[model samples]
Target: MSQHGVGLRAVMRSAAFLTAGALAVPALAGCGSPDPAGKPLAGPDTAPAARDRIADGGTLRWAVDAVPETLNAFQADADAGTTRVAQAVLPSLYRMGERGRPEINPDYLESAKIVDTEPQQVVLYKLNQQAVWSDGREIGAADFAAQWRALSGRDSAYWTARNAGYERIERIERGASDLEVKVTFKRSYADWKSLFSPLYPKEVMGSPDAFNEGARRALKLTAGPFVLKKVDRADDEVRLARNPRWWGRPAKLSGIVLREVPREKRAAALTAGRVDVAEIDAATAGRLAPHEGTVEVRKSLEPAFTQLALNGAGGPLADERVRRAVARALDRRELARVVLEPLGLPAKPVGSHVALSGQAAYADGSGALGGQDTKEARALLADAGWEPGTVTEKEKKEKKDKDKGEKAAGPKKDDDGSEEADDGTYIVGEDDKARGDDEELAQDGKQHLKQGGAPGAYAPKGTAAPARSAPGPLAKDGKALSLRFVLPSGPGSKTLATVAERIRRMLDRVGIRTEVSKVEEEGYFKDHIASGEYDLALYSWPTSAFPATDARPIYAKPVPAADGSLNVEQNYTRVGTDQVDQLFEQAVGTLDEGESRALLRKADARIWAAAGSLPLYQRPQLVAARSGLANVGAFGFGTPVYEDMGFLKKEPGSPSGKASTSASASRS
Candidate 1:
């Protein structure tokens, strides 16, 4: 097992990736970049600060894409917003450190260490006597046991988001005292510390009904610095107030307002003092240049990569050759270079879907397939029965005639020979709202233009009627083939829009057409991408430290359940194989680092071959913050110390009042 426990939040992030659109994998070790841990202030630029130096009671208006659909992070429909709120209000026994290692939260546990390896793996945990839930219940072994039983994957009735580490746990017992927890595992799990994170109370975990929807909209029990004050979806915010019953170091701020600001408005909100911190897009970062000293654009290498996902459950993408054709048409390398090179980071196509460039297990699995090749792409499409011409010779000629009058209707090429859309900022998220959890998924993944015209398509925003070209997408058996390219129209999506536009042009050259659907950022991941409502979509996946457990579900093959529906798990692409599953299982069971890496590499290769998604590049993690603020920014792998977050008080004679950046606590 990996030294760092790739436990709950680790698996939660992957499962959440299905809902939230983040897919950070397991095991991260790197250099020069902030993606890897252990470097000085490089990983997550939260601007560390001592508890005493921060000004004690300022409300921090934080920005998020949307308020979590569920307060329960373990629910299948929970998103990154759930994780955000959970980090501040719930109990994570071990939080991720700057270097991707899991460290104990002494506020909850006095110590947690492995006690045995033979017979059966066992871990001993000593709980903090003062650790108690918001309802005054002691945080005890009952909570752990209840959580294990609910998420152990043994019961199909629970509807857990994932059951990674729990499935291997044989049992959880109390030892010596009620505060002492003895976790016995059925196997050697390297990422043991990953479990018990964002730990829930027994009241919620003990019952299947409660675990399903009880905490979906509200949390009755919380054990962290902040408590749920309100979930105002109407206002697009999840408000958190300071927890008076908290036993740890007092939170420096009075409360946190997790406000949902569209990516486009986040910059204005920050400038107007409506938000103190926000994850800004590249263009937003650039736009904030004039406010440099006052508003700093903090950059961190996130454990995430943006990719193009192809729905393989039905339609043209269901064929492997067609999927490969789509992959070969796009110039991922050029896209990465054009977007990230200007940001001062070394830009290149993120080689592996399973791991980012900085991780020790990172490998270029897409290499054997070769780079973007138009000739090869056309060949693949033709071979797959997608004829090079349109549905009829007349349609092809009409398209050619229409092309003569227009400028070929493609992305405007910039002066540097690079493609540019109306804007340029990148955000990794879904593009529509969600429906019922158990509703039938969009297996064919199709969406049509239902309104007057595309709301936020290629044309500039506010265009009453944008031209939506409907030229014949190459057809087979007289059926026109086209993919619904879903994109987000929100605060920080200039980059996403640009990428989508370029993809459309590339595919157009090969006689493939796409219908663009610009959707709201709020439910994009939950409703559209994960639900397979779009035949083709672009989104990002955050990395995790435990690959076997965290990354497995993302690529695991969908299997038929007794309910007559395919239990796709987190493989929302609805495509995977037994070979990948076997590799992930072997990696999860192995304690040897070298062996695990080899298995993951093989799995990644198979994933690339499957062509479910094309890894594009490392998503840019740009956090815009007020200079005086501390303990918040592009967190990368580390979770924020919410209680330690606050603004700095000015020094006695310092005119600039900027010593605050340096006031952060020393790196561990």
Candidate 2:
């Protein structure tokens, strides 16, 4: 939800419901440059000799970057890892289809339909009679009611991560049968299917105590094809076994073991045959391309985009003109070109923050940021009362003295490492949302490691760096133009550091002094981003199938608690406007898909105009799987059907391959 917005930001709700699938063979070339349209072209040699025939009863040692903080997908800190596990072991009324569209899951629900649209929209869901929890509780209206109540935003104590569409519901009641759930919204919601996904049981969602404590140690029960068997934090692994209570087709593999292999070591794990499948990035994909005959690297555009979030509430970024100036100063295309081009990936500049390229509603609105205009950046700063000025050595010395004085006066941190002024709670945006202190769950939810750039200098081949019109640091009222840029620090952060440096250099040419800071990987989101402790930051938002429902929380107005701390939910940048929120409301309220899309585009234009964040490019999803793995690989805009995944019994071209393919193809 990037707020785990795959933080579950607005669609902290949508991004959390990501679409991924096993990759199809005919692997991409070793040099991963995306084609002209910013898409990757499959290489002739990369294709699987043929689909490896499926064989059952093998343990899949899948590589996950980290162990999930919480198994409960709805929790505030849940990330893609949580969702990956959740999809395999939990039951949702609907699951994402291959096309990134939602399809009703027949295993859980017999049917789900919009029964009424008039006086507040109504959705009726009928549960499958045979569908039951592993604990033997029948899936019914009570589970639906409890989930709705817990997420309705009526109870502050529930501690739910997002309440986008659920907050609009008037009530959830039993329909004609005990198994039927009737949900009526107070306001029309076009993407209601995004709700109750991986629905929780009554026992888990019933009360504040249950909601908070039930998911702490481990899941009590699960209704998916798999059930958690062990969570060995010491060993850094989570193991899942096929659910005995499953009423559907049995899972092909006997069990799944998610091993926490660091991104840097995943390739080694695969090469060593320690792991069966792993999520690979562009660089890693390229590195593994040599072993294409043995490993399949699948590449696709992810429903996410890396961005530069400018803090709008306080700090140097508070001024809209300054925010706009910062947006105009950077060369986003160059950044992409430098970072992704080397990977043989597309460097297409993203225009909309809400919609990625593959979505029907996507539109380029980057023009509002005015594409690398340093002259315009200077002019904007000038119009905002800025003037060129240089900081002298004496002034720097005095500033250091002042900083020392302030440090001496500041409150000391406790021996336990907690800040005296910290109060424990941190700010989370409707879009940027995390914490590492929560132990069983590290507070940091966003996974910055995997999506980080490969190690290299970010100097693109053809693009020239922007030139500065103003010579010295731009200033106004004696305040020098300076920004604190923060990014996660650890392995895989080389690209982010280089990108930040590139931005710093570009902004430097425009007379804006940028101080790049790196937070430890564990405290990156919690201490810096979610807490609003930086002037500017870099991160990505991975969207779910429901963009309209998810985009609002990322850009909606920040509502502060009475105590004055912001209840950021998912909007980490703390940027919003009446028009943006109004358009978001209109887009989600409309039932017409075309009209909804048009409204979203219009809303994106407004978002661009405000310039709190800039969409750089679509984040590439690359994964590497063993040659014999079947029904699993790079799933783009689709969730893998875990039940269908298995390892091949015989290598391709073997004598029995045809019969094995025929038998397993039918199962798929």
Candidate 3:
């Protein structure tokens, strides 16, 4: 099952409720300036300003969904959207480029040089005399040491796979102001520069476990271009003021205010001149198309890819044949056209586990599966001895509906009134066996059948019904098959559901079954996918500034957690092969990018052969800004360049300016 992250439906609903409530309630007599329409206002600007108010001091209200659970760099749990907000307040030593490459920035670090490279090792330097925190403490080697120990030691939740390469560290030597950190891998470790970034202050972090608590309270001690000035967790708002002590050039903007807004309201907020910028969903993108003079849409690439992960640990999905058949049943092209293309994006169908850009150096051949082909799908199922009636005709009907949008009921019942329940509770024309007998046998007397038929009565032996037989052969029912697809409920989830419905229709025409179940947000991650209790799921692989080559852990055999449960993030697919593992190891050890890409390609092919995940599409980070907002630069999933923004001021004779307030509005 391809797993997309949690949908934003709930968040959007909350936003709607808040907006509605705010509109329904009467306003106070005077809170702020009134609009030209003479209405009590929420903020200063009546119309969205073209150029930013050049004032030296004031707040710039920004918006985001949620705040981080921890401030510790090693333990931080933030989504890409949240990370983009944090980047403005926190500095990373190395910044990511458009092609997923990294480069050092002098603003944060005076200089970073590779002092040594030999014998399976490399050493680098952190200039100590150059930088300082807002509290006037010198930023130096101790901060680096503290950061490394904290990330590599315990409490490394924030230490992504990118940090795992640092485990080869041999020693750390400190100079008066500079820190010399040396790393020695058991074998040659590729992408060493990708390993370490800027280190956090040790004086503040103190210990690993205490880092989160300390950072939360010490929000004012950030070393970046901006400093946290106000944090209202209850209201889902945060404000960051310019850091006067920042080592870099002074920020152009005075401060940034981040408010958590729902995805649905983002487009309207931009159009109504309430918010300067926001991320708009694909469905809403169309509404903004006509307002080109007032809006600018930017399309960029992201490391994120949408995929369907198959839980092969148990159930009917245990068979690779079934998994591959399901992959063949999907119509990715249709999904891209009808579902994604409307949003002004393109979809690249891939069978490989690794993304197209990140393929290993050695990989050349295509992935294990190809694009949708119903005939081939039927052949695969036939070879696997799968029969049509067993899975349910709903799958076939759903698949057919994708292309034609025809609403067809599931399999028709015989005139004798022998039809199964839609819930899969009964199998028509089966032997007379009591319900729960197999369950009781499986549990070994843990559950007993009731004696009477009142509430929980078990049928007597003579009256017991036979176990319902599995659905009939697909060959008998036009080769129809039924497959279940699970996804999280949210605004983003609706897109996944549409895609699921499309796939269902396509497969139904090809003799396959597809059913989508939208699971609850909190329970979905823990009880569903992690426990191997799902059929298929849609998800994404969130890449970091330094993406590692540790794909094996996620696709290999399941790894049991410390509490004896399984780690869903790792290997839910239950696919393992010595060849693929070796390729992953080789790619990680290879220093050259070309070599690594080649190896990754090979590993991707092997993963495709295993049919672990069906690649659907890649997700892009989209932000919609009203016209007059300038200097908007997006750095992948990193941070938005707010300092660069300048409002577009309308000319005196312009129609818009005549009806709106003066161009010289002050910053709030």
Top candidate, metric lDDT? 1
Query: What's the TM-score of each model vs. the native?
Result: 0.74, 0.77, 0.71
Per residue, candidate 3 scores C-alpha lDDT tens digits across 418-502 of 2211110111001111000000001112222221233224556567665433233355335434456776553244455555656
lDDT by residue (1-668, candidate 1, tens digit) is 11121011211111123221122233333344443212322367788878777887778888887887787777756666788888888888887766655668888989988888788889999999998999898998899999999989999999986677898999999989998999999988866767877799998898888999888888899999999999998998888898999998999888888889876566677776678888765656755788777778877766666778899999999987788778877888767755565566556778787776546566666753456777777777777787744456886687678667545664445343533212232223221242110001111112113223335655666667845442336788878778888876653345666567668888887778887787876667767876788898876665676777787888999999999988987787898988789989898877666678767877887787678988887665678988888878877667688898988876678864465442431100
lDDT, candidates in the order shown: 0.71, 0.68, 0.50
CA RMSD of all predictions: 10.8, 11.5, 18.6
lDDT of 2 by residue, 404-494 (tens): 9855865334333432211111123311233211001011112122446333335588767656344787777778888888876543455
Error of 1 at 570 (Å): 3.2
Off by over 4 Å in 1: 1-42, 50-52, 67-69, 134-138, 153-159, 187-191, 208-221, 229-249, 286-293, 313-322, 373-393, 396-494, 504-535, 560-567, 656-668
Q: Which ranking of candidates, highest TM-score first?
A: 2, 1, 3
Q: Give the TM-score of candidate 3.
A: 0.71
Model 2, stretches more than 4 Å misplaced? Answer: 2-52, 135-138, 155-157, 207-209, 281-292, 391-470, 559-561, 565-567, 651-668
